[model samples]
Target: MIYVDPSGDDSGPGTVERPFATLQRARDAARPGTVVTLRAGTHRLTDTFLLTAAHSGTVYQAHGYGTPYQEKVVISGGREVTGWTPSGDGTHRADAPGPAPRQLYADGLRVERAALSLDGHTLRRTAGGYTVEGTGPQRWDGDVEFVYRGAYPWSEGRCRVASVSGDAHATTLTMADPAFAQATRLYHSVLTWEGPGAGESYGVDSPTSVENSPAFLTEGTFATAGPVIHYRPRGGEPPAGVAAPVLETLLHARGAHDLTFRGITFADATWLRPSTPQGFLHYHGNGYYDGGALETVTFAEGQGQVTVPGDHASMPGNLIFEDTSRTTLEGCRFVRLGAVALEFRGAGAGNTVRDSEITDIAGGGLVIGDGARDHRVENNHIHHIGLDYRGSPAVLVTGARDTVIAHNEVADVPHAGIVVYEGRGTKVLNNLVHDTMRVLADGGGIYVSGPQGDSHANGALIRGNVVRDTITPYNFGLYTDYGAAYVTVEANAVHRADAPVVLTVWPPLEHVTFLGNVWDADPGDPPGGVVLKDNTTVAGDAFDSDPRAVAITRAAGRRPARHRH
Candidate 1:
């Protein structure tokens, strides 16, 4: 066993009496089947911790993972910024010259970005810029961003601000080149019901809000002016600690096998690609379409709406595992991250992430990418995600084979809670999902789409889950969209959604069965090739009173003894 402690020296022997200072030192000294025990403290990382095939059969565990004396062990990817001085204004300033961070944590809580809402104002799109009524300032500090709600109910796009003109009550904010044009050319504003070819053409509406300007700097918000970062404390109280994320990834494993990580907190990592001039022109879930690679396709589903290219790029993760097989991560915490917390890429097999907590992220919580096989994600509590990018889901499984997503509690997301898009033998079982689609629409607490497998032997099963309180404007409790087929949804409970279940027929669903399910609303008659049998409908308030509903809710989500904190 190798030992690592924050207060130890690097030259010391990796023993309990004289532990090594850094994790890299311990990792380098380790052989196969070595257990690297990390002491209970924050281990800050300057660069990503890399693990290759040489690090196979290794276990990186916390000091007291299964003991009563277990304490917190944090792996941080943020650098401390000191010397805060007042800049004569209300905000405090500090010289934190580095890669621009998309997220900031003050006293271990997320501080909001400086923003101004233009919801009730008259803002018109212009040739060079937008002409807005009742503008606040003549000029602003830092790089500004226009946060737009376009693509109807699916996407939330952003564009960089180039320059501001005009004076006093009226302002013309010229958006930066290429990005603004790309955003406008991709994200459509009109719905499919508007006309026969309404959504075919590319268009974007006025921005719902503007972000990262000095004029928007207020209590509990922060902004940046070039290399200097500024923060205004809530109620004028000073922050005890502030973390500015520097590294995009904290851990990256490739071609490693037989690894385990237990009871470690990976925190404060940022992805800066979205903050660049390229901007985040969101498409669906965690994906965004690039304008340079323009390949538009038409989906016959739902009034023949146009779709972006299928090969869209997803938001990158802060912790990535690429082609790493037989890896397990348990009792870990992924928090305060700017992008996807963890991702499984390539054709990795037999990976598991269980008994973990993921929260306070700007993007998706977890993503099992295409080509992966036999992954298990269980008993995790994922909440308060999509904090910056509103279109990102809580958990997404795309094109993985024999993936099992079970016994997880997902909540407090702006978009879908759990999305399964194209996979074989995928089992989504005994999970509790709630309060999804709080901002964006056309998704659900549990959403499934695309073909499950080639035949019934490898078909998907979504069973014994409880989904409740899918917040309105629009959404469903359970949704099957965009050519979902060869799937069985059984023994699930759904309540308090815009609709109990929405099985789209425009794309012509095939061999999808809904059996022994309970909901507050009936979805009416089944379409061709779809079967709805042994399903019951109850009153909306019956979710609290009904014994079956209460039992299902109690049985779902994280198992009682498995929670880490």
Candidate 2:
């Protein structure tokens, strides 16, 4: 077995006795049957590690080792930033090694993107920017961002501050980027205005934006002025608590078989999205129907499902396994990364992500089965994701066949829970999804759409899942939108939702089935050629009830464990 210790020398022989200091040396020393073990400590990664078929092992055997939940092995993508110079304005400045990072951590915890309050103000969209009335507390530092809370379906408005004008009574922010159509203000007022989209410290009841102006500077807020990061501690300590992200991806496995990433931890990576306009899987209504490409008011041209994205969504991830079969990412923790955690795409069949925890990420979590087949996403807990976009799913699976999404526990997310779009024979079963639509609207806990255009989704299975506490008015517990056909919704429990189920497409949906399911509330009128049979309510509890309606007071989301490996 080849070994890697953080304290070892890179020039060593890579043996356990003469261990190597870096994983690259250990990986280079490994053969088809070789095993590489990482000694428990932090391994900082400045670049992505590629695992190809050259690194594949025998069938049902693993080539990499860290001991599942038994080791404290961390593969970090962030560099330590020390040598803080107090700027005397309640903030400290530090020079970093690489390009400036959009995400930073202090005291071993993820720091908040800067923001200020816009409470008790009126906002107006302008030709050049958006202006806030009754000027709140927002102050512009070297540069600041204008972000907003979405009141409409699938909306988030974010732009850099080009100029800040007006007096203390009112402030007009000339945005560097145009607002998204969904982010544009509807009618007059909204629940609140928001920006920079940070967690917790970002308010819930008031208008909030990340402000860097000296007037809004306080402890625990970090922003960039050219190449330096400005910070202020909560209690005014030394700048030792601050850390900045530098790298893009952590572990990237491509076209390898029988590889296992067991019990590894990935932390502190940054993925700053490009300032291009991006949208969700669906356009709600007013779509072009052909699915060729879409153009929004601001995001005009070149938007399609397999089409390359214009921004950081196209960047690499923390743990990426692609085009490999029988590969497993088991019992791992991916935290505080700037991009997606655990993405499996491109023709990797029979891959599995199980017993993992993914949280505190800026993008989507645990994406698998893009054109891949027979993938399993089971028994994982994913939460607190989409730190930037308000409409990203926790677990997104698209363009794959015979993919199984089962037994996952997803909660507290910004948007939807599990979204299965495109391909055929996709099964979503027995997963618990709650507290979704926490930020954006018009989504589903278990949402299914796509094949796009005149094409339709066929032979999809959505069953035995429990979804609750959906916060938005348009988000449902389960939904099939954009001409999904021949899909089956059966034997599930969905409650505490804006609506239990929604099937809409103008002329309505076709070839959809609702059987043996339990809903807290029935879906409104469906379209032609829809079938609803033996579907019950929350009173009957799996027993037969009234002639017109049945009551199901408890969750019907029960199943026997299926081990498909």
Candidate 3:
């Protein structure tokens, strides 16, 4: 076992007494089957360190000794700094004559000098003294005094504080006040108290605003309600012509079979960027062929921590897989993203995702096939997804076979909860789908569509799923179109929705079965090329207008035995 410390001596043997100075040196000296241990401290990394495919059976361990909490290592690419010059106006002046400017700290929020008044509390050379409603003002004889929570950007020795009114109430501040031309705006960093109640600490992106200025004031009431609080800028329009940043993915294999990463955190704080591009982390054919097998990778965020700017839309398509096999991801969280969370495109098989949380996404949550097959998605908690366009399914499976979807909780999406398109021999069972299609039209809990041309989707089993609280301008709970054939829907519970099921067949479906399903809403008249057998409904009447030439038997007050075909 060779111990390496990047900050320690390089002249001695690579042991605890005298460690290797650089990680590159330790990696170079290590052969296959070598366990290289990193010292228990922060190792600041710069540039990409490539562990090539040659070093097989080598485990590069970081912070492996001592208590796990005490062993800390941060691998970062360092910080990027940009220079700024003060305008030397009345609000900005050189307080100290030195190479580095004198630093000042403040408590209130930061705004422009033009928004300040004689009775207002500003950070401009103030030896603080005032009386608000007989309460003596707190005195701060410093060069810079903060009125509210301050804004800390990546600049050096400069911050802005919010202004206070004569009554000791904080005023709404703006970034358009000429003092913030080249400034970075940190949103909603204020602490407020109403009367004798406990103070509330607002997060950075509270008080939603839609102004064009960089800093929009937040919305909050004083001890007594004042003007409507709305002066902040909502982050929507991409900063002029600056396109979103592109995320670069680097994958390396070190002769290890079964490389997996689970419960990792990836977040972006800047606006005008998509956080990440579509398919940020992807693996296709290289890692496995080079004596490595990547399996069971999970990427999720921590609880209650908002990863992106609250005003912007959700991020998109964080993970994509192609030709990888037997992977599973569950109990994860995604927010403020654009496209799908986990997507498998091209010839992958046997993946499963369940019991996870996905929300605030513009696109769908899980899409299981462009060419993949035999996937199972079960028991997931999916909500607040599909905010972008219409027709986005929370779980969409296309061009896949023998897939099983069961026991999941899905809601608040813009499209259908589960959609099986161009897939054969798939089963959707015992799931609860509700509150879908929030924005656009064409909503449904489950939609099954067939493939075009010579490819036919045959033999699907849809059973025992509960559909509720679905609302849209158009559509139904279960819809089939084109050449979909041999589908079985049985013993399902649907409640409080318009248009429960609509089956449309253009090319004449073959051997369709609807059995023992209970519908609380009006079960619409079935179309042609469908069969209904012994289906029980609470609304006594069989069908509004039967379009299919099949037997419809209703057995009420009698318990029906479970039947399987």
RMSD after Cα superposition, model 2:
7.4
Candidate that beats the other on lDDT, 1 or 2, i.e. the better one: 1
Which candidate model has the greater lDDT, 1 or 3? 1
lDDT of 1 by residue, 449-514 (tens): 989987666888999999998995668899988889998999999999988888654567888999
lDDT score for candidate 2 against the true structure? 0.66
User: Where in model 1 is the C-alpha error above 4 Å?
Assistant: 133-137, 167-170, 189-203, 293-304, 562-565
Give the per-residue lDDT of model 3 (tens digit) for 232-286.
Answer: 1113211111111112211222222212222221211111121111101111100
Show where candidate 2 strays beyond 4 Å: 58-69, 87-90, 119-126, 130-139, 163-173, 177-215, 275-316, 451-458, 505-507, 539-565
Candidate 1 is scored at a TM of 0.95
Highest lDDT among the candidates is held by which one?
1
lDDT of candidate 2 over 186-270, digit per residue (tens):
2122222244331222111223465544456567777776677787777877777567878877778888998766667878877
For the record, the alpha-carbon RMSD of candidate 3 to the native fold, in angstroms, is 18.6
lDDT, model 2, position 21: 89
lDDT of residue 325 for candidate 1? 97
Name the lDDT value of residue 482 in candidate 3.
46
In model 2, state the lDDT of residue 85.
88
